[model samples]
Target: MTSSQEQFVQKEIQKISLPSANTMRLLEINSNPEHCLQDVIDLVKLDSALTARTLRIVNSAAFCPLVPINSIDRAVSYLGEKMIVGIAVTESCGKILNQPLEGYESPAGDLWKHDLFTAFAAKEVARYAKNGMEADLAFTAGLLHDIGKPVLSKLLENASKTTIDALDHGEAKDYLAAEKLVSGVEHAEVGYQLAKYWQLPAPIAAAIRFHHNPSEAIEEFQPLVYAVHLGDIIAMMSGYSTGSDSLQYTLDSHYENFFTFSSNELTKIISDTETAFRPALESLAGKEEN
Candidate 1:
């Protein structure tokens, strides 16, 4: 990003509103970092919408081959604690995602589909990395990664339409850069601010802020960001909208050099993951209709 782009991104970030840090703390407490599966389950049970959404998903067509996960615990046990964490967070995120964001040229619920696809793709990458970072976290992180775009777009109003149109036409290099070029700020900085406002876990927040350009990420999150970047690229190639935003990839040859997997390994991961989660994501998205 150029200096002007950097300045633009910073200037635009001032316009967005995000959830409070205290709320994020409450979310983290409910999520239970100590691995208390029961605490997470108990919390999920209280949020009626969340509980209904989760159960509906478990019993949906995606899980049809297996008998319905009769109750919350049954669903938890069936999906495992990590995946449950991922599911709960994604459900929480779904509320905002379903809203229409004209800034990105996204209609009513398109953002959720894009988010779900990225989350599923991120989960696949986490499964492959097997680096002890839970798959569910990766999934949630992916789903929320682009969250700043909507917030920024909402704040900028008509001013951002040109940027959104450019992204839709594949004319922009990177979403942030394009946003900066037009609105005077990038989405990553805006997202980071939003994450902080939401009190999201540091890792998740960092991942969202840096997923587009993993090369500059700190040590703890570099791999996860790498996975998300690759996942985003693959998703675009597979047919999700790359938009006019995020057209220019910040990857360097070194990123390829450092990637430990062979092309064949990545191919299999992408193919297998798409097949595994497409139905699940589609079913989850359809619940809004009922």
Candidate 2:
């Protein structure tokens, strides 16, 4: 990206609201390896709006509890950290995440569904990491990976077809390349800028920055970044794509250094992600409809 476009991304990022303090704290606590369920419960208890949302989701049709659970402790325990974080982050960032991206030809809610699907896929992929990885952290990183799209989408509004044409004629290698060619800024770089402004955890920031090109991430973060990368492609293949950009990025074979799942396992991962995504989508996005 040029200096002028970089300046524009920074300016647009400033207008985006930071996730609420409670949501930030919840993310921090959940990202920590030492954190337990009690930490999440305590944090959720401190935010009345979050607490109410938690209760409403837990009792919603998605979970189908034997009885309505009223206690915050039971609610948090039943939903688990992954779902809780999804609920909290959605409450804070739903507007931006759910916004229509006219530039991408993605209607309202497409980005949100894609991100949520990728999150579940990443979490499952993390489980097979050669070295131990936090599934929940992967889930969190995956959920926010595409956040820069909404900011850069406007710039692409008029250039979308031109960019796609470049891809068809091989004028640009892929969507990301076309994005830079057309708008002088790609969504990943824009998202990285926003991730820094939000003061998100380093792992997440790296995942957002390098998800499309995992090999470029720092050595320490490559595994987590690779998980999100694969998850992204899996989401697109499974039909949770964000409009025209779906399946447009290259997959790095270097991921073999971190994961050794067989072809069958990969298929299972995709299936499992689809199974998990629906309930999450309903729990996190369905409440508003009712």
Q: lDDT: which candidate is best?
A: 2
What are the per-residue Cα lDDT tens digits for candidate 2 across 154-200?
88886778989989999888899989989998899999999889998
The best candidate by TM-score is 2
TM-scores, one per candidate: 0.76, 0.96
Q: Can you write out model 1's per-residue Cα lDDT over 1-290, one digit (the tens) per residue?
A: 55765455556454444433333443475334465667667766776665676677677766663666768877766655445544554555556667777666556676666666677787776665644555666666676777777666654556555776666687776556667666665667778877775667777787788877787788877766776776666666666643444334544444453355678987887787688666666666665335
lDDT of 2 at 252: 92
- Write out the backbone clash pairs for model 2: none
